[model samples]
Target chain A: QIAVANAQELLQRMTDKCFRKCIGKPGGSLDNSEQKCIAMCMDRYMDAWNTVSRAYNSRLQRERANM
Target chain B: MDPSASGMGSVDPRLRHFIEVETQKQRFQQLVHQMTELCWEKCVDKPGPKLDSRAEACLVNCVERFIDTSRFIVKRLEQTQKSKAGFSESLSD
Candidate 1:
């Protein structure tokens, strides 16, 4: 589906941006340790994303109730 | 940012559907970017083999409070604007 491709592109961009943040400079190829770092980085990034998402969702819910 | 491009049904259905999906996708990406930047500062120290539970919790709280703050500001502004309509109107003009 077109949706999947768009999602993939966004994921790719996020990976690039976050990797750069988590990894300062590229070493010769991705060494074993670096690969592990990236994997964890990806997981943590997703965790952070979900956290913010849930937070925002709840905030919206509370605000709606107030209104 | 422009909604005019997606206005009305003049394009192919498939393309229109694609546009709708892409718009949603972009919104997700934008939020993810914002959240990443925020939680990076709050949760991340030196990159490690795995993300510790403490940092993970911080990330969740960060996101929730960020949204809460945004809502709080919006509501506060609306309330203030009611009494300061002339002030905002002058700025808008």
Candidate 2:
């Protein structure tokens, strides 16, 4: 359940973000270039998420070790 | 009637622990989502073919500095609150 919720949260954020990045104007339809941009944006967003997660986990571990 | 034990008898200790762990994990995941959105704005100008090295470094630094900023604000607030409390007490006396 937690995993499902997490995925849903990621999906929502990704949709919002990619929409902002890819769509400059309210086009009648998602153009081919816009679709491509959204695909790339989704991948980059996941990469960014994993990078942030690793950084935070390491920071937590470092703090724990200090304590 | 002991209020603390009113509804505690039926829950298994292991189940409670599992829930606690799950809650903690969820909190971490939620923060990751927030920070990713924030740092994405700061680091990424445009989504490229891949996440470039420069953008990745920026994201890592953004996460670290963001945490530092949070800690600094918390500590500063505590200090100010403590001083405010002392000032109020002195004024009362």
Candidate 3:
């Protein structure tokens, strides 16, 4: 249940972000280049998310060790 | 839900632990989402064929610095509260 909710939320956020990043003007339709940009943006967004998560988890582990 | 089964004691301890761990992980993921959106703006000029090395480094540093800033704020607040408590105690005495 929680996993489903997280996935849905991630998708929603990705759509919002990718739209802003890729679409300069909301024209009649999503052009081919815009579609391509959104695709790449989604991948990079996931990469960034994982990178941040790893960095944060390592920091948490370091703090736990200190305590 | 029955009144007889109102408390968490009714739940399996293992399941409870699983929920707790998942909740912690979700919190981390949620923060990552937020920070990624924020740092994406600051670091990324354009989405390229891949996440560039510089942008990747920026995202990592952004996460670390954000955590540090939060900890610093919390510590500063605790110090302020301690000093205020002392002042209030002196006034009451």
Residues B1-93 of candidate 2: C-alpha lDDT, one tens digit per residue: 877566656889998789789989999999999999999999998989999999999999999999999999999978987867885567669
* Cα error, candidate 2, residue B67 (Å): 0.8
Candidate numbers sorted by DockQ from highest down: 2, 3, 1
- Give the C-alpha interface root-mean-square deviation per candidate: 3.2, 0.5, 1.2
**Per lDDT, what order, best first?**
2, 3, 1
The residue ranges of model 1 lying beyond 4 angstroms of the native Cα positions read: A1-13, A58-67, B1-29
B5-49: candidate 3 lDDT, tens digit per residue: 477677998988897899887887788778877877887778889
Among incorrect, acceptable, medium and high, the docking class of model 2 is high
DockQ of each model vs. true complex? 0.38, 0.93, 0.74
Q: Which 10-residue window in model 1 chain B sums to the lowest lDDT?
A: B1-10
Using TM-score as the measure, which candidate wins?
A: 2
> What is candidate 3's CA lDDT for residue A39?
92
Worst 10-residue lDDT window for candidate 1 chain A reads A1-10
Cα lDDT for residue B90, model 3?
70
True contacts kept of each: 0.53, 0.98, 0.79
Two-way DockQ contest, 1 vs 3, winner = 3
Q: Write the per-residue lDDT of candidate 1 for residues A1-67, one digit (tens) a residue.
A: 6457646754785588567765667777777766777787777666666666666666657767999
User: Which is the winner by TM-score between candidate 1 and candidate 2?
Assistant: 2
Q: Model 3: how large is the Cα RMSD against the reference? A: 5.3
Candidate 2 chain B minimal-lDDT segment of 10 residues: B1-10
